[model samples]
Target chain A: MDSTNGSQTLEAQAKAFFDSAPPLQNTHQITQKLDHFIQHSSANGEARRIVCVTSGGTTAPLEQRCVRYVDNFSSGHRGATSTEYFLKAGYAVIFLYRRGSFQPFCRSLPDDPLVECFEPIDELNIQVREAYSEAVKRAIVDHHAAVAGGLLLKLPFNTVFEYLQMLQLIATSMRCLGPCAMFYLAAAVSDFYVPWKDMVEHKIQSGSHILDVQLVQVPKMLSILRKDWAPLAFCVSFKLETDSNILLNKAAAALEKYKMHAVVANELTTRKEHVVFVTSGDNIIVQRDKSHSGNDLENPLIELLSERHAAYIKDSNRQV
Target chain B: MDSTNGSQTLEAQAKAFFDSAPPLQNTHQITQKLDHFIQHSSANGEARRIVCVTSGGTTAPLEQRCVRYVDNFSSGHRGATSTEYFLKAGYAVIFLYRRGSFQPFCRSLPDDPLVECFEPIDELNIQVREAYSEAVKRAIVDHHAAVAGGLLLKLPFNTVFEYLQMLQLIATSMRCLGPCAMFYLAAAVSDFYVPWKDMVEHKIQSGSHILDVQLVQVPKMLSILRKDWAPLAFCVSFKLETDSNILLNKAAAALEKYKMHAVVANELTTRKEHVVFVTSGDNIIVQRDKSHSGNDLENPLIELLSERHAAYIKDSNRQV
Candidate 1:
């Protein structure tokens, strides 16, 4: 197909996906929050850099009432850790995370921190346990500062429908920032979904020995975000594969096809240790500092991305 | 087929299912914990009543590496609330739960209590906020008491494979308790699963426009639990359906087929407000006490079940 026809086909598919989706439960509230956060962050000619860091896994509901769902694999570690780094680097972060996934500044705490890290001092008071006092204090102080200072905005999503719609809203809202906006697409979005209209209202009965489910492909929204929503925004997408052999190739393909500033490629097993930055010029391999016991891969990865974003911003200004 | 032939077929299927499944990661640790807890709870000829309460929803992994999986809908509220009542009724609880699901004594706390309910007092200290001090203190004290007093043994699982395997271990370990042992199967278990041997090792590639997944029935383990694992243990299974029309019939059928002491019939909509206890003799409808706003359906349901269990114990002693 010609380029024009391809773009049109993709546009139609994206439109259909959004048109048929069940409307988000809190679209108005979310949009208002985004607008307020964006305006506050960019207030008084500050021109502060803001990045929307998408995190965790999106679900594909099998039924309209959703007795069952297909979930992508993500603990949201990357996004959470990266959000911390971005905040530390003096950037406002809009954390679009899956509900109940990891949170920024809470990585050092236990999974059930409330139950595990605290004890009742008396009938009316509770105190953090001695062993966890330092970690808990740090997490609370840092998290409070971020949220209170209007430097962080956390939005949660569960289903693919909610994720896509929210992402579009965020991208469009951030478009006003021009090249200062960044899209850190790290969420493990579902590749396929059962359309809302076609889904069964009731839970699928288990009487049948063999169950057959047909899941249609979720529309690719990256092209739309690049071409329409926020063309000047610095975008980075991720490629996670169990097989190392095909990881970089797929990432490179994505970078070219979606016009992403860079594609982060990492094998599933080694993702925590290292990642390859697939860009137009050359592939840059970033790794966690082995000598530093507390170092995370996201630390170095975010640093590199921020540098690239800065360079891109400079180039965009030069063109203007 | 005749009863004997049917039993044989079921046995074979169950065996095949277990044989083909991947081994649990921490079987030895789980078994050791169960043994210690059971022995401690039954120490000094106390003959304490012990109930294995399975909570939350089990996942059915579509791939061996599990980048994506099918998940059942369950907040684990029923199981968690029932556990609190069982503890209050002087029963040791073996909480076999899905990881990250609701926990006993934690129902009243906010979802992210660590962040929401606490504030940093200094660099090395944290205190529960005044608004949440009472709730936090109660939860911490109660949870600590139950865990430290050897009344609650919490074991967590993720997939159906882990849930079933751990359940078998718990049951066989509890077999010596005879009538003192009980099984409260409240988890939303997956009815279908992709066999481990047939699952792809890597994450399923999403290049295809349409993905076709064929899931086979997960073998019914309730019958095996009754006849083989713990013959004398009183088992109360649960039936949760979205359609209230088929709920009672299905619960009754399950009660008869599995020879459960009772089956709790609940609809998705009204589960928090009410449930029906389907037994051999009569059906009892239990509802939350509306006169008291703090009242929960599980409180009355557990009270009734405890009374019936006491009668059952008396009958068993008379027979002995």
Candidate 2:
């Protein structure tokens, strides 16, 4: 029974191996890695679409010495939780997430040095409990990753300089992905840090001290997106407002500033509700929703994003 | 005869008591602290200037996943070792350094943290140095320093965000003092860290995997001197370059970029012989001499800095 059955099994294995494509290596590896590049295969729709997603918050130090700091309230939960929906809807996602924070939200995320905060002090001190939790989450995510239709890239940084650098670098890399779609879900960047001058030691007497920081403006790297990246690629950015009355205006200003196609504006309020305003040169509109709790109203979010973005995507059409 | 001698001794005691004054509880404390500040003052033609210095480096963790991280490149050799020259010049220096790495340096210079890095990590890994080197440096910099020139406040952080935040926050506190001078000789402000997006995870992953970092741009916080802190405050920035060729141009750009009145541009190679170009507007040009063996040269460098900068003092009419 063993020999006869084994012969049949061997024949099946041989047939499967030969029928499958050749083993990937050299140029073939590129084809293998990018095979997912065609996921939005809607035949009746006729136009293919892609989406970009950003996740995280922005913050600054509290003390003038900057040994201590504060972060805007963004758990990164909404962004990660929403990504699965974007993927299930058949859109490729360029997930730009903070280094370790995004680890649990999405496993099978690619490896990158930018996400690795090389702080030696934090290296030895990371509690085993956390490491265990991350490991377990990674295992679970990897278990399900084979069927997921998108990619996650982790980028980490202490100060804002590194953050902007990676953004510029990614804008260039996105060119290879074809005319794409973007989702700006990451929290806004921090406002300030020790001024570069004071990053050097400035003297003060031990007592009765008064410290002063002279802040310089950071160049808006986001300006490059509308000016370059998503002209052919669909782009989305975010506007977060903790202050009242400023949310929509600021979001609109941000759209004009980035010249973006759409923006997902959020508030610091307790409600899980969000008012998404899709913007362009001649068009603008707002959509409000309160479907706070569920497997995620992702299907709705995706439908809105894709439908609203259709004209822009079709207009740009395969920029590469 | 005994009564007469006792009377004279009593008179001397009264004089000493009157000069001591009261310990600083508030602004009045500045009067008491001024002597210590004045005594430590770096003397020039006249003791008209006070220089505030922050030495050492700041480090922070990437993700809050209980895995703290840090980044610090200062050896204390530059800030601590070179400070002696400034001290010998008789400038009253307010030196703020880190908890662990700068202890030996602190033993020689002055100033300690009012608060410390007190995170509940495994080993007090000292976010940069697990536990509080706190009031220890505080205890030493000035045991009597309950109050001093410019309100001396101290705080700590696990990430560069905290470090930078502290610097950003407290930096301007000194403006309340309205002091005439300040010096920045510290090193090791990491050019980068965990991206704001990844600020969540406990730890970024490991292994020789390829991870793409979508770097975001951080603002140049140091470029402050050009505006909120100019003229009233003479400012100098730094430049780090890997190659040669129009190196001075690079330094000039920094000066123009940060609006710093001056820039101490040096290459990694300048660590030893200490070659540098000190730029302050188009009017000032002092090329550093690349000659010296260890401590012998420290005195000369101070002289160069003092003499050139002395022109800015109230006593001198020179615009530099």
Per-residue alpha-carbon lDDT of candidate 2 for residues B1-320, written as tens digits (9 for 90 to 100): 11133434434433332233222133334333544444443233444444445555655444443223334445445555445555556454544555434432233322212111222233222222334344233323332231232323222233344444444333453343333565553545544344544465422322112222222222344544334433355555556554445557777766765566567665555554554645654433333344532344445656666665566554434443
Candidate 1 docking classification: medium
Best by TM-score: 1
Question: How large is the i-RMS for each model, in angstroms?
Answer: 3.1, 23.2
Q: Write out fnat for all predictions, comma-separated.
A: 0.65, 0.00
Q: Per-residue CA lDDT of candidate 1, range A285-311, in tens?
A: 999999979899988889999999999
DockQ of each: 0.59, 0.02
Q: Which regions of candidate 1 fall more than 4 Å away from where they truly are? A: A1-5, A121-125, B1-5, B122-125
User: TM-score of the second chain in each model?
Assistant: 0.97, 0.59
Estimate, for each residue in A1-320, the C-alpha lDDT of model 2 and write its tens digit.
12233434534533332233122223343333334343333233543444546666543332333333333334466566556666655555555554323432332222211112111223122222333334333333432352342343334443444445445445554555455445454544644333333343222111111223323233344554555544455677766554546667766776765566677666556224445554754333333344453434344655677676665555656442
* Model 2 spans with C-alpha error above 4 angstroms: A1-50, A58-73, A102-139, A142-150, A176-178, A183-185, A193-198, A201-208, A280-293, A297-299, A318-320, B1-320
